[model samples]
Target chain A: DVKVTQSSRYLVKRTGEKVFLECVQDMDHENMFWYRQDPGLGLRLIYFSYDVKMKEKGDIPEGYSVSREKKERFSLILESASTNQTSMYLCASSLLDRSNQPQHFGDGTRLSIL
Target chain B: AQTVTQSQPEMSVQEAETVTLSCTYDTSESNYYLFWYKQPPSRQMILVIRQEAYKQQNATENRFSVNFQKAAKSFSLKISDSQLGDTAMYFCASEHTSGSRLTFGEGTQLTVNP
Candidate 1:
């Protein structure tokens, strides 16, 4: 089974603090994604990395950035945490294959910004 | 941009009954994939079922199945013999054939009563 491990299951940060959410997938998938799931808005993509050092901004990537220094690890960085940024963060990974493979997601990191 | 919508905000069904969750999407891209994802209270996103735009037959997985109407741009999920474990938030998502990003709907909360 594929396993996506999130560094933190629960996190609390101040408004101006810098936050980092880490994700590691054991499947060595080539594509990794960061998404923030909100109550009524659903899961909005923040950023995605198709390969090491290659990242693309998604619809809701305004206050977020991503890094993929290695194939197994992907990181989501909140430039400065804001109260509005408080939500459940999910990390997903899928193989960059021609076949339609499902993206496996981590348990999720519930971040609370005060 | 592709947008997904789940009209039903909440739905309930008896343990032995069946329930269906509706999903509609707007997209200009002809080649794409539609998916239903289940997010339980544990906050983990699990892929329920997926349907390819080109496939005429709907997809099914055990007790879970999809009613895909390509021309109507509608994809609904039906859970047969509903169980308490089926209680969760069901999200409809779409992904373009050329891209890996998934656009998700607001989600419909499902409850299976005994």
Candidate 2:
């Protein structure tokens, strides 16, 4: 079974703070993704990395960035956390194959900004 | 880019009954994939089922199955003999065969009453 582990399950931060959310996958999948899930709006992609040191912006990438320094770890960074940035964040990984494998997701990190 | 839509925001069913969640997608690519993911109270994204555009047969797993209509770009999930454990927020998503990103629907919150 694949395991995607997020460093924190619940986190609280003050406004204007820098927040870091870490994710590690045991499957060594080539693609990693960061998404923010909000009520009614569902899950929206924030950023994704296809390979180490390569990142791409997703639909909702403002105020968020990502790093893939190693194949097994991906980190999501909020430059300046705001109250509106508080939401459930999910990390997922999948094999970068043409077969279109399903993504395996972590348990998710629910961040609260005060 | 692909777009997934789940019109029903919430649904309910009694235990041992059956329920179906609807999803529609719009994508220009002929080769694509569709998926149904369940996010339970635990906040873990679980892949319920997957369907490939080139396949004529709908995919099924245990009591979970998908009704896939390639021409209409519709993919719906049917849960038979639903149990209390089936209660969750179900999301429908789509991705191109060659692409790395997934477009997800707003999600349908399904509640199963005992």
Candidate 3:
């Protein structure tokens, strides 16, 4: 079984603070993703990394960035946390293969910005 | 941009009964994949089922199945003999064949009553 682990299950930050969310996958998948989930607006991709040091902006990448210094770890950075940024964040990983393998997700981190 | 839609916001069904959740997507890309994901209260996203756009037959997994209509761009999930454990937020998503990002719809909250 594949295991994806997020560093924090619940987080709180003040406005204008820098926040980091960490994720690690044991499967060594080549693709890692960060998503923000909000009510009435499903999960939206924030950023994704296909390989170490390679990152791409997803549909809603504003105010957020990602780091993939190693194959097994991906981190999401909130440049300046705002109240509107409070939401559940999810991390997922999948093998970059032709089989179209589904992504395995970690238990999300619910972030609250004060 | 690909857009996935789930019209049903909330649904309820009794244990041992069946329930269907509807999903539709609008995308210009012909080659893509559709998926249904379940997020329980534990906040873990689990892949329920998936269908390739090129496949004519719908996909199924045990008591869960999907009705995929390529021309109409509609994919719906049906859960047979629903159980309390099946209660969760169901999300519909799509991914282009050339990309790894998934576009998701506002989820449907499902509750199985005893």
Worst 10 residues of 2 chain B by lDDT: B94-103
Comparing chain B with the reference, what is the TM-score for each candidate?
0.98, 0.99, 0.99
lDDT of 3 by residue, B47-98 (tens): 9998999889999999999999888989999999999999999999999888
Clashing pairs in 3: none
lDDT of 1 by residue, A1-114 (tens): 999999999999999899999999999799999999988888999999999999999888998888899999999999998999999999999999837699999999999999
Report the alpha-carbon TM-score of model 2 versus the true structure.
0.98
**Candidate 2 structure quality by residue, lDDT tens digits, B1-99:** 788999999999999999999999999998888899999999989999998889999999999999999888899999999999999999999988878
Query: Which runs of model 2 end up more than 4 angstroms from their true locations?
Result: A98-100
The root-mean-square deviation over C-alpha atoms between each candidate and the true structure, in angstroms, is 0.8, 0.9, 0.8
| RMSD value for candidate 3 | 0.8
For each candidate, what's the DockQ?
0.84, 0.82, 0.86
The per-residue C-alpha lDDT of model 1 at residue B91 equals: 97
